[model samples]
Target: MIIEISAGAGSPSEQIRDRVTGLITTGALARGERLPSVRQLAADLQVAPGTVAKAYRSLEADGLVVSRPGSGTRVSDQASSVSPALARAARRLASTGREDGRDLEDVIRVLRAVW
Candidate 1:
């Protein structure tokens, strides 16, 4: 929920989207957790409200979050449940790779190649 927007990054909306997605996928934002209001987040990030709205819309479309009138936005309970599980699996994989003596860069390279 602590998003730092870099001026040198891509479009503001894209940066917002990427950060939110990363948080969800890494299990930092739990399912059903409410996100800051679009206006509030935009003000905090110094971007237009529309930018945050666009990012929220994108996350909604991707099944990563949900927004309801009066309730604001929250992580999607169903889809988000899968993200933490996937993150846990990834962490286990990384741990096993390290135990097997694989360097971080090599593990990253393998992951990228496979991906």
Candidate 2:
């Protein structure tokens, strides 16, 4: 799973939590799939281990993931995925925006305005 941390966005922990949540809900991370260990993801993201741990704790609190001593973290079975139709529409929007020479910020701004 790829998680990007934007300096101008929320805190590193929040960004991690939100990104992982999005991945789970969009079916990018399957149910019962193991997430990177706290240390591993922290090293990958260049954040502290505590940051990834905090995000994992938040996800656990939200019932979106489960963490065990030996198993690491996995998406919870109850973590519902977004409908395929909605996922398709999102991909379509992203593709169309890129094809139209629009940057991510531009597409996000339009999405925000529409929302």
Candidate 3:
């Protein structure tokens, strides 16, 4: 469970939400997998607990995760990852980017331009 925060990306909560969303969509976070508690993630990320909570709430609203009092937050069983073809393409792009010595921001910039 790794989540990196970028100061330039957006608000802390938005960055968390986006990263967690990517993890779930990329199948890095499996369905029914439990997430770190809000406090735990905040502590790990050195952000406010409210930031993590906001991100979790957004994920819940998007149907990517579910939370319960005692059960904590878990990836929603109904949540689905990207299509196989897309995943393969992403992997290829990532590999190519790495080989070309392109950083993540560079790759993302190219992707945005292409989009």
Candidate 4:
């Protein structure tokens, strides 16, 4: 569960948001998988608690994650079905990266360039 914040990425909260979205999209964080508490993520990511809270709140608003009263946050069951295009794109990016020795980031850039 290591999330590395890139120096060239966006703001901390947005970066966290993107990373969490990637986790759900790639199935790394499965439906109903428990996420770290906001305090815990803040400590681990060295970001403010508010930053983590903002990211979690955004995910909740988008229905990608759910907060349980005492059970912590869990990846939403809906995330698995959120976007057909995203799922397909994720799979394609993974396959392209594996077969051609391209990175997923590179694949994304190429896809964007072509389309």
Candidate 5:
């Protein structure tokens, strides 16, 4: 998977995490699709391997991705089970926030307050 991190986005790790999440939610990344290795992705994104690893760890914790010895990481089948409507809404909200020059944390705070 080719992942791009916006220069003005949040931290590298958070940007990676959000990008992967968006890909999964939008069905661009299919269930069980293997993702690039942490080292590979870090090199591609020009970030530290630890940053990519951290993002992968967070995704795994959220049940969006899975990793196994020698198998690398793959999108979890259950990841696609997230409600499409909800995902779309989230993407829209994030886009709106970015357009409004709000950071992700600020958007998250608003979501938390509304939720």
Candidate 6:
């Protein structure tokens, strides 16, 4: 799972929080998926370790990432699911991005693929 912390997009913490949350919400990162260490992710994104740690702390508080002693942080089971609106919006973007540009067929295709 890639966690990007864009400095200009939002408060560093909020950007980190949103990116991680979005991944979980979109199912790009599955339940129990291990996350990079704070030091590692911080170096990768060029953000301060405190920023990544803050985001990880926020995620843990939200019941999204669980940290175990000696083991890495993992995605919580709660992240395996998302709210209906977000799920729908993600499908809409993917379905609409096709060459047909979001016709009923696209919707049906998404429905079939999902359902």
Model 4 lDDT per residue over 18-103, tens place: 88988887677889999999999999999899999999999999999999789999999888744667777767777977799886
What's the lDDT for candidate 6? 0.81
TM-score on alpha carbons, each prediction: 0.72, 0.78, 0.77, 0.71, 0.75, 0.69
Residue 26 displacement in candidate 5 (angstroms) = 0.6
Better of 4 and 5 by lDDT: 5
Question: In candidate 1, what residue range of length 10 has the lowest lDDT sum?
Answer: 78-87
lDDT of 3 by residue, 1-115 (tens): 8999987869999999988998999888999999999999999999999999999999999999999999999999999999778988988998999999999899999999999
Please give the TM-score that candidate 6 achieves against the real structure: 0.69
Q: Give candidate 4 misplaced runs (Cα > 4 Å).
A: 81-115
* Model 3 TM-score on a 0 to 1 scale: 0.77
Candidate 2 structure quality by residue, lDDT tens digits, 1-115: 8999999878999999989998988899999999999999999999999999999999999999999999799999899899989988988998999999998799999999999
lDDT of 1 by residue, 9-54 (tens): 6899999998899788787888899999999999999999999999
lDDT of 4 at 85: 75
Q: How high is the lDDT of residue 111 in model 2?
A: 94
User: Model 2 has how many clashing residue pairs?
Assistant: 0
Candidate 5 has a TM-score of 0.75
RMSD of each: 5.4, 3.6, 3.6, 4.8, 2.7, 7.5
Per-residue alpha-carbon lDDT of candidate 5 for residues 1-115, written as tens digits (9 for 90 to 100): 7688887768999989988988888888989999999999999999999999999999999999999989999999788745788778877998999999999789999999998
Error of 4 at 56 (Å): 0.4
lDDT of each: 0.89, 0.94, 0.95, 0.86, 0.90, 0.81
Ranking by TM-score: 2, 3, 5, 1, 4, 6
> What residue pairs clash in candidate 2, if any at all?
none
TM-score of 2: 0.78
